[model samples]
Target: MVNDIAIIAIVGGLTGVTTVLFGFGGGFVVVPFVYQLFLRQPVVANHALHIAVATSAAVMIFNAGWATYNPQRRRNLSANILFPLTLFIGLGAVMGSLLAGQLSEAVIRLLFIFYMLVTIIDCLVSRHFLKGSEARPLSALTTTVGGTAIGTVAALLGVGGSVMTVPLLRKHGFSMKDCISHANPLSLPVALCATITYTINGWGKIPVSGFLGYISLTTLAILIVTGGVGISISQRYLPKIADGWHARLYVLLLIAVLVAMFI
Candidate 1:
């Protein structure tokens, strides 16, 4: 038991570091890690990925809060755009969470793989759009679309939607830094809604012990502690290293990670 907790903490720490460096909370890492760790146990293996995702999101709420507060002390995020879109995202999140209960693990895994592939393709093909002029008027529409897509993906896979949202935002002319900064706060509504929906829908379905619905409280606690430390470290240094080529590298890395999961 102590060994398992230590393993989870180590993985969570690695995930937090990756998230900080990449500006994505470590859902990609956490999901697979949890899946593998619990693969042999009767510990609800089918829902491991979902639990990983939700637990990661719970951790992100903490990381995002820290990130948002640090920056807001200097300048406010563009909340005017974030507010309306959050409503749609919140709605979509609830819908997606409910849907997760009805879907099988096979279906959710396929959807997650498909979404990752699309994200990779978009990153490679639309690399040119990363530096275009910001479409201020279109922010609301774009936010809605982005939020809906993100919500669906988040509930389906337990990822925070950064894999999709970050690239999309960059394609629409936002710099990587601003895109990440904005996404941290933007994610809150979807996370909150999805967490709630998953809880409600998963009630009485998930076996209790270390779980609340599909979320594992024990796993969440470990992730929070390590991820928090990692976020602080990453925030202090990541901005300096994140350049134009980093996105392509991340795309390749994500693809490799996804392929490894199936193998």
Candidate 2:
């Protein structure tokens, strides 16, 4: 247990770095780690994905909140681009969480993998993301429609929604920095909605200790502190990264997490 906690603490720090540098809000880092860890415990093996997703959602709430305060990140946010989109994402998150609670762990994991693969392919194929200039005003249809989709998938997979939002923003000519920064703000809705939904939906579903519905409270406590530490440390150097490299690394990190899920 001691070693496991230490390992989780380390992962928490990494989550913070990713949250600050990539606006992942700890979802990408925490999900695979928690999922695999829980799978190793005989008592929780069957419930691993549920716990993993729920706990990731719980962790993301704070991670996103902490990341949002970064001065550099805050400057990139656009009220017009964020408003109605955020409202719709929250609605979609509710739908996604309910659906997730009913699915088999294997099915959910596969869906997460598929989502990652599609995002990776789209980013690689889209030339606009890499050479983005001034961000244009977003269209109403894209905001309402796209936001809902991002929230649904993100909540279902227990991710921070940055994977979808960052790419969407980048495609619209937002800089990698702007996309990542805005991703933190956008993820807050997904994280908040998913947490409440997962807790209520998962309650009593798994008769396990140290759990609240699907969430692992112990892990959440550890991650809160360690994730905060990570966000603080990573913020110092976020400005040093170039836009192209930042975008490339974001995709690479997703590929790595996708591979990690298999392992």
Candidate 3:
């Protein structure tokens, strides 16, 4: 229990920084760590990935919520624009969670690996393609469709929806801070829906101590505390960063996390 608490503290700190800086739910970072932790335990080894994904989703609720709340408190978010996106994404997250419950651990890991690689490559190459291009606003219908897609994919991969939401917002002419702000809020619903579904799915299946359907409440509590501190620290810097630098930094961080995920 002491060791777990220590590890959770570290994860929470990292997650807090990542959530605020990148508008992530911290799932991309948290899932891997949790998955590896689960893997080391014999009883839950067969369901490690499922547990990891579920737990990550549960933790993301707090991470993304705080990430969004800080900006909203500053009057940075546009509710008119964010509402529809959240509705669609939230709906999709529920469906995605249901789908995820049917997949095997190996399958989930492979899918997540594929997603990380594709996203890393896309982030690296897309900068050249986007040079000099102006962001264009999408229609309401388009936004809904896009949000649904992002939510679906995010839930499956045990991540906050920001990986896709930020790019979508950027494409629609939102500034870096605005993109992060919106992405952070949008992730809340995705994480919430996924968490509920995961909890329901794992009912009567996961029999590990300190687990409630794969979510470690003890870890969640530790992470929330440290994550809050991290968010508070990172929030001060996010708005000051330039858009280009934000993208570059995001790519670097993604690469680092992906490497960590595999290692």
Candidate 4:
């Protein structure tokens, strides 16, 4: 347990950086860390993904909430991009959480990997995510369909929805700062809805003393504190990242997380 806490502290710190800089809300990184951690405990290894995903969802609430309140991020937020879309994201998160609870750990992991692969390919093959597009309106379809799909997949995989939202915004011609800003706020609904559903559905399931359903409260607490420190340190560099570098780094980070998942 001491070892777990130590590792979780490191994970927490990294998540904070990811949250403020990438709008990851800690999911992409945390899920893999927690999942690997649980996999080593024979007693809970079978349900490792659930615990990892649930814990990641819970952590996102704090990380995203904190980042959203950041003065710098607040300045870049676009109301037109976040309004109706966030509502649909919340609705879809509920549905995804329920569905994730029904699947086996192996199945869920595979789906997460698949999601990463597809998104990575899209980002790499497309020029839009790197170079901003022409000016475009926030379309209704993107708000409804796109937002729902992002919420569903993000919740199902415990990825905080930024993996999808950031790229979508970028493709629509938003600056990296604006896209990341929107991503942080957009992650709030997915995190809140997914955490609620996962917590409720996982009651009495994970047989660990530190667990709250599928969440490891002990790990969550440690990570939260360390993650806060990370966010504080990283947030200062938010404006330093150029638009092109930020987008490229986002894809690179995705690939890194995807590789970690496979390992």
Candidate 5:
């Protein structure tokens, strides 16, 4: 039991460190770690991944909220663009969370592989094309479509869908920095809604040590504490880092995670 607690602590520390460095990492790092840690207990292994993803989403509500709030206070962001899209995104997230429980682990793993591959390709091919574009007029149809797609991807992969949103916004003419800034705020609602959905859907299904719905409270606590501290520190240093270097790091991390998934 002590050994298990120690392992969980170490994993939690790593998750927090990565979360601070990147806006998201619990699903990428912690989910796999949890799976491996409980590999001998296969009955619980599948649910561990869901717990990690759901907990990570729950943790993001705090991390992303902090990241977005401080900046928004300093400079006015176009809330009008964010508000309408967020409404649909939240609704879709709930739907996606409900769907996750019905899918097989093999299907989820395959979907994760596809997601990682697409993200890697997107990072490589679109480096020069990532200029921030302007917000398009949000039509009801576009909001529903984009939100639903983002929510589905978020639920499956544990990413905030910023990878998709940032590019789409850039393509529409928003600047890269602006797109990132906007994406941060948008993630809050999506993550919050998704967390709630996963919780409700996963509630009797997950058998983690201290799970609530799909979320593991112990894991969420570790992530929140560590992630919060890490993000605070990283925010101070990230600006000094070169954009190209950051992008390269992002790609490398994704590749590493993808390889880990297969192993």
Candidate 6:
């Protein structure tokens, strides 16, 4: 029991920083660690991946909320700019979560790997094309479409949409900080919608020790508190980072995550 608390708190704290800086909710990092934990319990092994994804989504909700609040307050980002994408991202998250519950684990794993590869390449390609282009606001239709795609992929992969959304936004000419700012709010709806779907879909299917429909309520509570503290600390350091470095780091991290996932 004590060990579980320690693990959740540590992961939650790391995720808080990543969620604020990259809007990833650290799922790429969290899922693997949680999967190993679930593996230790034979009874839950059958459904471990699902629980890991769901739990990650649940944890992201609180962290994403903190991530969004502080930045919007400091940056004074317009809610009007974020609303359309947010709405569509939420809708897509619901649909995505439903689809995820229906798919086999093997398929999901393959899809996750494919997405990482595609995202890395996409980020690299965009660096070339977007280098000198003038920054422009994404249109409402574009935002909605992008949000839907992001939410669906995020739910399937158990990540906050920022992993995908931020690069796309950067490609479209937004600053990394601005992209992270917008991506943070987008995560709220994605996490809420996906977490709900996981809870409902896994109601009786998940048999893990702390299961509350794939969300371990105990872990959720720990993450909320520790993750919030982490977010607060990271926000102060955000401005010191450059956009180019962030993009590069994201690609490296994704490659490392993919290797870890396979191993």
- Cα lDDT tens digits, model 5, 82-145, are 7677777667666777777777767777888898898788767874443223446656776788
lDDT: the better of candidates 2 and 4: 4
- Report clash pairs, candidate 3: none
The residue pairs that clash in candidate 5, if any, are: 20-231, 132-173, 132-174, 132-175, 132-176, 133-173, 133-174, 134-173, 134-174, 203-213
Q: TM-score order of candidates, best first? A: 4, 2, 3, 6, 1, 5
Computed on alpha carbons, the lDDT of every model, listed in order, comes to 0.67, 0.87, 0.79, 0.89, 0.65, 0.77
Clashing pairs in 4: none
lDDT of 3 by residue, 32-67 (tens): 887888788798888888887888888888888777
| Candidate No. with top TM-score | 4
Off by over 4 Å in 5: 1-22, 40-43, 72-76, 127-144, 173-175, 206-209
lDDT of 1 by residue, 1-263 (tens): 78888888887777666665555666677777777666646757766666666666666666555655675322735766566766766666777777877777677778877877777777777844333445443365676776786777775677766676667667767666666666666666656766776666666666657678766788888887888877777767655644465655667677876885676
The numbered model that scores best in lDDT is 4
**Candidate 3: where are CA atoms >4 Å away?**
71-74, 128-133, 236-239
lDDT for residue 189 in candidate 4, whole number 0-100: 88
TM per candidate: 0.86, 0.96, 0.92, 0.97, 0.80, 0.90
Which stretch of 10 consecutive residues in model 6 shows the poorest summed lDDT?
126-135
User: What TM-score should be assigned to candidate 1?
Assistant: 0.86
Q: CA RMSD for every model? A: 2.6, 1.3, 2.1, 1.2, 3.4, 2.3
Between the candidate structures 2 and 5, which one is better when assessed by TM-score? 2
Clashing pairs in 2: none
Cα lDDT of model 6 by residue, 31-63, tens digit:
877777776778888777887888889887877
Stretches of candidate 6 off by over 4 Å are 1-5, 71-76, 128-132, 237-239
| Least accurate 10 contiguous residues by lDDT in model 3 | 126-135
Give a tens-digit lDDT track for model 4, residues 68-104: 9988789887778889999999988888988888889
Taking the candidates one at a time, how many backbone clashes does each contain?
0, 0, 0, 0, 10, 0
